[model samples]
Target: MKIMEYMKERFQNLEFIPSIYNQWGIGIHFCLGENIYQLKEKEELNLKRFQVVYEQITIIFNELFEQNDDIFLVTNMYKHKKEKCIRKLKVYQPFLKCKNQKCKNHLNQILVKTYPYPFEINKAEEYEMQQFSLLCKPRDLRVTELLKAASNEDFPLKPKFGGYSTDYPDVFFVNITKDNIFFIYDDRGCEVIALDFKRIRHLYEKYHDWVEEYKCM
Candidate 1:
Protein backbone atom coordinates (compact mmCIF):
# COMPACT_ATOMS: atom_id res chain seq x y z
CA MET A 1 0.00 0.00 0.00
CA LYS A 2 1.01 3.61 -0.46
CA ILE A 3 2.27 5.66 2.53
CA MET A 4 -1.01 7.56 2.57
CA GLU A 5 -3.07 4.41 2.70
CA TYR A 6 -0.91 2.91 5.41
CA MET A 7 -1.26 5.97 7.64
CA LYS A 8 -5.01 6.04 7.19
CA GLU A 9 -5.31 2.44 8.30
CA ARG A 10 -3.00 3.03 11.25
CA PHE A 11 -5.02 5.91 12.71
CA GLN A 12 -8.29 4.10 12.13
CA ASN A 13 -6.96 1.22 14.14
CA LEU A 14 -5.99 3.64 16.92
CA GLU A 15 -9.62 4.58 17.48
CA PHE A 16 -10.21 1.18 19.06
CA ILE A 17 -7.97 1.99 21.99
CA PRO A 18 -9.88 3.15 25.09
CA SER A 19 -9.10 6.27 27.09
CA ILE A 20 -7.08 5.91 30.30
CA TYR A 21 -9.68 7.85 32.27
CA ASN A 22 -12.51 5.28 32.31
CA GLN A 23 -12.40 3.02 29.32
CA TRP A 24 -13.80 6.01 27.49
CA GLY A 25 -13.05 6.01 23.80
CA ILE A 26 -10.64 8.67 22.58
CA GLY A 27 -7.78 9.12 20.14
CA ILE A 28 -4.21 9.96 21.15
CA HIS A 29 -2.73 13.42 20.72
CA PHE A 30 -0.43 14.49 17.89
CA CYS A 31 2.30 16.36 19.82
CA LEU A 32 4.39 13.36 20.82
CA GLY A 33 6.68 13.37 17.79
CA GLU A 34 9.64 14.75 19.64
CA ASN A 35 9.10 12.39 22.53
CA ILE A 36 9.05 9.43 20.19
CA TYR A 37 12.20 10.63 18.53
CA GLN A 38 13.90 10.97 21.89
CA LEU A 39 12.79 7.50 22.92
CA LYS A 40 14.17 6.10 19.67
CA GLU A 41 17.48 7.82 20.21
CA LYS A 42 17.71 6.48 23.74
CA GLU A 43 17.17 2.89 22.59
CA GLU A 44 20.16 0.62 22.83
CA LEU A 45 20.60 -1.03 19.47
CA ASN A 46 22.80 -3.74 20.92
CA LEU A 47 20.19 -4.81 23.41
CA LYS A 48 17.20 -4.52 21.11
CA ARG A 49 16.56 -5.47 17.54
CA PHE A 50 15.16 -2.38 15.84
CA GLN A 51 12.80 -2.92 12.97
CA VAL A 52 11.40 -0.67 10.26
CA VAL A 53 7.85 -1.35 11.41
CA TYR A 54 8.51 -0.34 15.01
CA GLU A 55 10.18 2.88 13.94
CA GLN A 56 7.40 3.83 11.58
CA ILE A 57 4.57 3.09 14.02
CA THR A 58 6.16 4.85 17.03
CA ILE A 59 6.60 8.07 15.05
CA ILE A 60 2.83 8.43 15.11
CA PHE A 61 2.33 7.10 18.62
CA ASN A 62 4.38 9.74 20.40
CA GLU A 63 2.66 12.53 18.54
CA LEU A 64 -0.74 11.33 19.69
CA PHE A 65 0.32 11.31 23.34
CA GLU A 66 1.76 14.82 23.35
CA GLN A 67 -0.96 16.42 21.23
CA ASN A 68 -3.56 15.57 23.82
CA ASP A 69 -1.61 17.31 26.56
CA ASP A 70 -2.08 21.04 26.93
CA ILE A 71 -1.12 22.85 30.06
CA PHE A 72 -3.89 22.28 32.64
CA LEU A 73 -5.18 25.76 31.79
CA VAL A 74 -7.94 24.62 29.40
CA THR A 75 -9.86 23.05 32.26
CA ASN A 76 -9.50 26.22 34.34
CA MET A 77 -11.21 28.33 31.67
CA TYR A 78 -14.28 26.12 31.58
CA LYS A 79 -14.78 26.28 35.32
CA HIS A 80 -14.51 30.03 35.53
CA LYS A 81 -17.07 30.49 32.76
CA LYS A 82 -19.49 28.06 34.35
CA GLU A 83 -19.34 29.88 37.68
CA LYS A 84 -20.26 33.20 36.04
CA CYS A 85 -23.30 31.65 34.38
CA ILE A 86 -24.38 30.18 37.71
CA ARG A 87 -24.07 33.42 39.74
CA LYS A 88 -25.18 35.65 36.87
CA LEU A 89 -21.78 37.24 36.75
CA LYS A 90 -20.88 39.42 33.85
CA VAL A 91 -18.15 37.77 31.82
CA TYR A 92 -15.25 40.08 31.08
CA GLN A 93 -13.50 39.83 27.77
CA PRO A 94 -10.20 41.50 26.91
CA PHE A 95 -10.21 43.73 23.86
CA LEU A 96 -7.87 41.98 21.43
CA LYS A 97 -9.01 43.09 18.06
CA CYS A 98 -8.24 41.02 15.04
CA LYS A 99 -5.19 42.44 13.24
CA ASN A 100 -7.15 42.42 10.00
CA GLN A 101 -8.93 45.73 9.76
CA LYS A 102 -11.07 44.82 6.76
CA CYS A 103 -11.85 41.31 7.92
CA LYS A 104 -14.74 42.33 10.18
CA ASN A 105 -13.39 40.07 12.93
CA HIS A 106 -11.86 40.55 16.36
CA LEU A 107 -10.16 38.30 18.95
CA ASN A 108 -10.14 38.07 22.74
CA GLN A 109 -8.70 35.78 25.39
CA ILE A 110 -10.83 32.82 26.50
CA LEU A 111 -10.25 29.97 28.88
CA VAL A 112 -11.54 26.41 28.51
CA LYS A 113 -11.78 23.89 31.34
CA THR A 114 -9.98 20.56 31.33
CA TYR A 115 -9.10 17.65 33.60
CA PRO A 116 -6.80 17.74 36.65
CA TYR A 117 -3.09 17.97 36.11
CA PRO A 118 -0.80 14.94 35.64
CA PHE A 119 1.56 16.28 38.28
CA GLU A 120 1.81 18.56 41.29
CA ILE A 121 3.20 21.92 42.31
CA ASN A 122 4.94 22.70 45.60
CA LYS A 123 5.25 26.44 45.11
CA ALA A 124 1.73 27.82 44.82
CA GLU A 125 2.92 31.33 44.10
CA GLU A 126 4.57 30.33 40.83
CA TYR A 127 1.20 30.20 39.13
CA GLU A 128 0.44 33.75 40.25
CA MET A 129 3.86 34.92 39.13
CA GLN A 130 2.97 35.29 35.49
CA GLN A 131 -0.06 35.63 33.26
CA PHE A 132 -0.53 33.37 30.29
CA SER A 133 -2.79 33.16 27.23
CA LEU A 134 -3.92 29.88 25.74
CA LEU A 135 -5.49 28.70 22.50
CA CYS A 136 -9.14 27.87 22.80
CA LYS A 137 -10.47 24.55 21.72
CA PRO A 138 -12.98 24.49 18.90
CA ARG A 139 -16.65 24.24 19.79
CA ASP A 140 -18.55 21.00 19.34
CA LEU A 141 -19.65 21.63 15.78
CA ARG A 142 -16.28 23.04 14.84
CA VAL A 143 -14.51 20.06 16.39
CA THR A 144 -16.74 17.70 14.45
CA GLU A 145 -16.07 19.54 11.23
CA LEU A 146 -12.37 19.41 11.88
CA LEU A 147 -12.52 15.65 12.45
CA LYS A 148 -14.33 15.19 9.19
CA ALA A 149 -11.79 17.32 7.38
CA ALA A 150 -8.90 15.35 8.86
CA SER A 151 -10.35 11.94 8.05
CA ASN A 152 -8.94 12.05 4.54
CA GLU A 153 -5.34 12.63 5.58
CA ASP A 154 -2.37 10.30 6.07
CA PHE A 155 -1.96 11.72 9.57
CA PRO A 156 -5.40 13.06 10.14
CA LEU A 157 -5.71 15.82 12.72
CA LYS A 158 -2.02 15.83 13.45
CA PRO A 159 -2.89 17.77 16.56
CA LYS A 160 -1.10 21.05 17.05
CA PHE A 161 -2.13 24.45 18.38
CA GLY A 162 -5.08 25.71 16.39
CA GLY A 163 -4.91 29.33 15.32
CA TYR A 164 -6.32 32.27 17.30
CA SER A 165 -10.02 33.16 17.10
CA THR A 166 -12.55 35.55 18.63
CA ASP A 167 -14.62 32.94 20.44
CA TYR A 168 -12.12 31.88 23.12
CA PRO A 169 -12.05 33.93 26.32
CA ASP A 170 -8.67 34.16 28.05
CA VAL A 171 -7.93 32.06 31.14
CA PHE A 172 -5.10 30.40 33.03
CA PHE A 173 -3.96 26.90 34.20
CA VAL A 174 -1.89 27.45 37.25
CA ASN A 175 0.67 25.62 39.47
CA ILE A 176 1.41 22.58 37.35
CA THR A 177 4.33 20.30 38.43
CA LYS A 178 5.83 23.15 40.42
CA ASP A 179 3.15 22.64 43.05
CA ASN A 180 0.17 20.36 42.79
CA ILE A 181 -2.58 22.84 42.10
CA PHE A 182 -4.90 23.77 39.26
CA PHE A 183 -6.51 27.18 39.08
CA ILE A 184 -9.15 27.85 36.45
CA TYR A 185 -10.60 31.24 35.58
CA ASP A 186 -13.38 32.38 33.28
CA ASP A 187 -13.55 34.93 30.49
CA ARG A 188 -14.05 37.71 33.02
CA GLY A 189 -11.02 36.82 35.14
CA CYS A 190 -12.83 35.16 37.99
CA GLU A 191 -11.65 32.10 39.83
CA VAL A 192 -13.91 29.20 39.03
CA ILE A 193 -12.43 25.87 40.09
CA ALA A 194 -9.35 24.96 42.06
CA LEU A 195 -8.15 21.40 42.41
CA ASP A 196 -5.07 19.37 43.17
CA PHE A 197 -3.26 17.24 40.65
CA LYS A 198 -4.32 13.77 41.63
CA ARG A 199 -1.96 11.85 39.41
CA ILE A 200 1.57 11.46 40.64
CA ARG A 201 4.32 10.45 38.27
CA HIS A 202 4.22 6.99 39.75
CA LEU A 203 0.50 6.71 39.20
CA TYR A 204 0.56 8.15 35.72
CA GLU A 205 3.43 5.89 34.83
CA LYS A 206 1.50 2.89 36.06
CA TYR A 207 -1.36 3.87 33.80
CA HIS A 208 0.85 4.76 30.87
CA ASP A 209 2.65 1.46 31.18
CA TRP A 210 -0.62 -0.15 30.19
CA VAL A 211 -0.02 1.20 26.74
CA GLU A 212 2.80 -1.30 26.44
CA GLU A 213 0.29 -4.00 27.26
CA TYR A 214 -2.17 -2.36 24.90
CA LYS A 215 0.33 -2.71 22.09
CA CYS A 216 0.21 -6.47 22.50
CA MET A 217 -3.50 -6.48 21.91
Candidate 2:
Protein backbone atom coordinates (compact mmCIF):
# COMPACT_ATOMS: atom_id res chain seq x y z
CA MET A 1 0.00 0.00 0.00
CA LYS A 2 1.03 3.64 -0.33
CA ILE A 3 2.80 5.29 2.58
CA MET A 4 2.07 8.73 1.13
CA GLU A 5 -0.76 10.26 -0.88
CA TYR A 6 -0.75 11.38 -4.48
CA MET A 7 -1.50 15.07 -5.14
CA LYS A 8 -3.46 14.14 -8.20
CA GLU A 9 -5.32 11.05 -9.31
CA ARG A 10 -3.60 11.22 -12.68
CA PHE A 11 -0.27 10.37 -11.12
CA GLN A 12 -1.69 6.92 -10.44
CA ASN A 13 -1.21 6.12 -14.12
CA LEU A 14 2.58 5.99 -13.86
CA GLU A 15 4.64 3.05 -12.63
CA PHE A 16 4.19 2.07 -8.97
CA ILE A 17 5.66 4.25 -6.27
CA PRO A 18 8.70 2.73 -4.57
CA SER A 19 7.34 3.63 -1.15
CA ILE A 20 4.53 1.21 -1.80
CA TYR A 21 5.02 -1.35 0.93
CA ASN A 22 5.27 -4.95 -0.15
CA GLN A 23 2.65 -7.37 1.01
CA TRP A 24 3.73 -10.12 3.41
CA GLY A 25 7.25 -8.75 3.32
CA ILE A 26 9.74 -8.58 6.19
CA GLY A 27 11.97 -5.52 6.68
CA ILE A 28 14.19 -3.56 9.06
CA HIS A 29 14.07 0.01 10.34
CA PHE A 30 17.48 1.42 11.36
CA CYS A 31 16.60 3.81 14.17
CA LEU A 32 18.20 7.23 14.20
CA GLY A 33 21.14 6.71 16.57
CA GLU A 34 19.51 4.71 19.35
CA ASN A 35 16.73 7.28 19.25
CA ILE A 36 19.06 9.64 21.10
CA TYR A 37 17.88 12.56 19.04
CA GLN A 38 14.49 12.23 20.73
CA LEU A 39 15.88 12.05 24.28
CA LYS A 40 17.53 15.43 24.21
CA GLU A 41 15.32 18.45 24.85
CA LYS A 42 18.28 20.78 24.65
CA GLU A 43 18.74 21.63 21.00
CA GLU A 44 22.53 21.84 21.24
CA LEU A 45 22.95 18.41 22.77
CA ASN A 46 20.66 16.85 20.22
CA LEU A 47 22.44 18.47 17.34
CA LYS A 48 25.78 17.26 18.65
CA ARG A 49 24.61 13.67 18.97
CA PHE A 50 22.82 13.90 15.64
CA GLN A 51 25.89 15.06 13.79
CA VAL A 52 27.91 12.06 14.86
CA VAL A 53 25.19 9.51 14.12
CA TYR A 54 24.03 11.24 10.98
CA GLU A 55 27.51 10.90 9.57
CA GLN A 56 27.54 7.25 10.51
CA ILE A 57 24.18 6.65 8.86
CA THR A 58 25.33 8.53 5.80
CA ILE A 59 28.32 6.25 5.67
CA ILE A 60 26.08 3.21 5.88
CA PHE A 61 23.86 4.53 3.09
CA ASN A 62 26.84 5.30 0.94
CA GLU A 63 28.13 1.80 1.46
CA LEU A 64 24.80 0.36 0.39
CA PHE A 65 24.58 2.67 -2.62
CA GLU A 66 27.48 1.63 -4.84
CA GLN A 67 29.22 4.32 -6.85
CA ASN A 68 28.21 2.83 -10.22
CA ASP A 69 24.78 1.44 -9.49
CA ASP A 70 21.76 2.67 -11.38
CA ILE A 71 19.65 4.93 -9.13
CA PHE A 72 16.13 6.19 -9.21
CA LEU A 73 15.16 9.68 -8.05
CA VAL A 74 11.57 10.62 -7.39
CA THR A 75 11.63 13.88 -9.28
CA ASN A 76 9.13 16.11 -11.19
CA MET A 77 8.92 18.70 -8.41
CA TYR A 78 11.58 21.13 -7.23
CA LYS A 79 14.72 19.69 -5.69
CA HIS A 80 14.03 21.60 -2.48
CA LYS A 81 11.04 23.17 -0.75
CA LYS A 82 9.90 24.73 2.52
CA GLU A 83 9.22 21.92 4.98
CA LYS A 84 7.60 23.07 8.21
CA CYS A 85 7.98 19.57 9.57
CA ILE A 86 9.42 16.27 8.49
CA ARG A 87 7.63 14.71 5.49
CA LYS A 88 5.34 17.72 5.16
CA LEU A 89 6.66 19.11 1.87
CA LYS A 90 5.54 22.56 0.77
CA VAL A 91 7.16 23.42 -2.52
CA TYR A 92 7.76 25.61 -5.56
CA GLN A 93 8.79 24.55 -9.06
CA PRO A 94 12.32 23.15 -9.01
CA PHE A 95 14.10 24.24 -12.19
CA LEU A 96 15.98 20.97 -12.66
CA LYS A 97 15.59 19.37 -16.05
CA CYS A 98 17.75 18.03 -18.81
CA LYS A 99 19.04 21.09 -20.66
CA ASN A 100 19.74 18.98 -23.73
CA GLN A 101 18.27 15.95 -25.46
CA LYS A 102 21.26 13.87 -24.51
CA CYS A 103 20.75 14.63 -20.82
CA LYS A 104 17.00 14.18 -21.08
CA ASN A 105 17.45 10.84 -22.76
CA HIS A 106 19.97 9.90 -20.12
CA LEU A 107 17.40 10.73 -17.44
CA ASN A 108 14.11 8.91 -17.06
CA GLN A 109 15.46 6.52 -19.65
CA ILE A 110 13.46 3.77 -18.04
CA LEU A 111 11.56 2.87 -14.87
CA VAL A 112 9.45 5.82 -13.70
CA LYS A 113 7.08 6.02 -10.75
CA THR A 114 4.95 8.83 -9.33
CA TYR A 115 4.39 9.09 -5.62
CA PRO A 116 3.64 11.70 -2.97
CA TYR A 117 5.31 12.69 0.26
CA PRO A 118 3.62 13.27 3.62
CA PHE A 119 2.52 16.81 2.69
CA GLU A 120 -0.49 15.59 0.73
CA ILE A 121 -2.09 14.71 4.01
CA ASN A 122 -4.72 17.11 5.41
CA LYS A 123 -4.58 20.69 4.07
CA ALA A 124 -1.11 20.59 2.55
CA GLU A 125 -2.69 19.18 -0.59
CA GLU A 126 -3.12 22.75 -1.76
CA TYR A 127 0.38 22.50 -3.17
CA GLU A 128 -0.53 20.33 -6.09
CA MET A 129 2.43 18.40 -7.43
CA GLN A 130 3.38 16.24 -10.40
CA GLN A 131 6.19 14.12 -8.95
CA PHE A 132 7.56 11.20 -10.99
CA SER A 133 10.63 8.98 -10.87
CA LEU A 134 13.84 9.33 -12.89
CA LEU A 135 16.55 6.77 -13.54
CA CYS A 136 20.27 7.31 -14.18
CA LYS A 137 23.76 6.26 -13.19
CA PRO A 138 24.90 7.36 -9.74
CA ARG A 139 27.21 10.01 -11.18
CA ASP A 140 24.48 11.38 -13.41
CA LEU A 141 22.38 12.20 -10.36
CA ARG A 142 25.36 14.20 -8.97
CA VAL A 143 25.11 12.50 -5.58
CA THR A 144 27.60 14.67 -3.68
CA GLU A 145 26.20 17.94 -4.95
CA LEU A 146 22.61 16.87 -4.20
CA LEU A 147 23.55 15.80 -0.68
CA LYS A 148 25.69 18.84 0.07
CA ALA A 149 23.12 21.36 -1.15
CA ALA A 150 20.20 19.79 0.73
CA SER A 151 21.33 20.11 4.35
CA ASN A 152 18.57 22.49 5.35
CA GLU A 153 14.81 23.07 5.18
CA ASP A 154 14.11 21.28 1.93
CA PHE A 155 12.50 17.87 1.55
CA PRO A 156 14.90 16.57 -1.06
CA LEU A 157 17.66 18.88 0.16
CA LYS A 158 18.06 16.63 3.21
CA PRO A 159 17.26 13.34 1.53
CA LYS A 160 17.87 9.75 2.60
CA PHE A 161 18.09 6.36 0.84
CA GLY A 162 15.90 3.32 1.45
CA GLY A 163 15.87 -0.20 -0.06
CA TYR A 164 12.43 -1.77 -0.14
CA SER A 165 11.50 -5.23 -1.39
CA THR A 166 8.16 -4.34 -2.84
CA ASP A 167 7.14 -7.58 -4.56
CA TYR A 168 9.85 -9.72 -6.06
CA PRO A 169 12.61 -8.17 -8.27
CA ASP A 170 13.19 -5.72 -5.38
CA VAL A 171 13.48 -1.93 -5.55
CA PHE A 172 15.74 0.76 -4.13
CA PHE A 173 14.15 4.12 -3.40
CA VAL A 174 16.65 6.82 -2.56
CA ASN A 175 14.84 9.80 -1.14
CA ILE A 176 17.73 12.02 -2.13
CA THR A 177 17.18 14.64 0.60
CA LYS A 178 14.72 14.33 3.39
CA ASP A 179 15.25 12.79 6.81
CA ASN A 180 18.21 11.74 8.95
CA ILE A 181 17.48 8.05 8.74
CA PHE A 182 19.16 5.59 6.37
CA PHE A 183 16.60 2.81 6.02
CA ILE A 184 16.91 -0.65 4.44
CA TYR A 185 15.00 -3.88 4.73
CA ASP A 186 16.53 -7.31 4.22
CA ASP A 187 14.47 -9.27 6.75
CA ARG A 188 13.23 -11.35 3.85
CA GLY A 189 12.86 -11.27 0.07
CA CYS A 190 16.13 -11.14 -1.86
CA GLU A 191 19.19 -11.32 0.37
CA VAL A 192 21.01 -9.49 -2.40
CA ILE A 193 18.66 -6.60 -3.06
CA ALA A 194 21.63 -4.29 -3.44
CA LEU A 195 24.93 -4.10 -1.59
CA ASP A 196 26.13 -6.72 0.88
CA PHE A 197 26.09 -4.28 3.84
CA LYS A 198 29.45 -5.52 5.11
CA ARG A 199 30.08 -2.22 6.86
CA ILE A 200 26.60 -1.89 8.34
CA ARG A 201 27.00 -5.30 9.90
CA HIS A 202 30.42 -4.30 11.19
CA LEU A 203 28.85 -1.21 12.78
CA TYR A 204 26.15 -3.35 14.38
CA GLU A 205 28.62 -5.91 15.62
CA LYS A 206 31.02 -3.43 17.15
CA TYR A 207 28.47 -0.75 18.00
CA HIS A 208 25.14 -2.40 18.64
CA ASP A 209 23.78 0.59 20.51
CA TRP A 210 24.55 2.84 17.56
CA VAL A 211 21.87 1.15 15.45
CA GLU A 212 18.24 0.17 15.97
CA GLU A 213 16.10 -2.36 14.08
CA TYR A 214 12.35 -2.45 13.64
CA LYS A 215 9.75 -4.06 11.33
CA CYS A 216 9.03 -1.67 8.50
CA MET A 217 5.58 -0.12 8.38
Candidate 2: stretches off by over 4 Å: 1-24, 34-47, 75-129, 145-207, 215-217
Best prediction by lDDT: 2
lDDT score for residue 159 of model 1: 25
- lDDT against the true structure, each candidate: 0.24, 0.35
Stretches of candidate 1 off by over 4 Å are: 1-99, 102-106, 109-119, 125-217
Query: What global local distance difference test value does model 2 have?
Result: 0.35
Report the C-alpha lDDT of model 1 over 137-184, residue by residue, as the tens digit.
211113322222222122222221222221222322222223221111
Candidate 1 C-alpha error for residue 191, in Å: 28
The top-ranked prediction according to TM-score is: 2
Q: Which residue pairs clash in candidate 2?
A: 78-94, 150-157, 156-177, 158-177, 158-178, 159-176, 159-177, 159-178
lDDT of 2 by residue, 47-108 (tens): 55435444654555575566555445443331223432212121111222345775646443
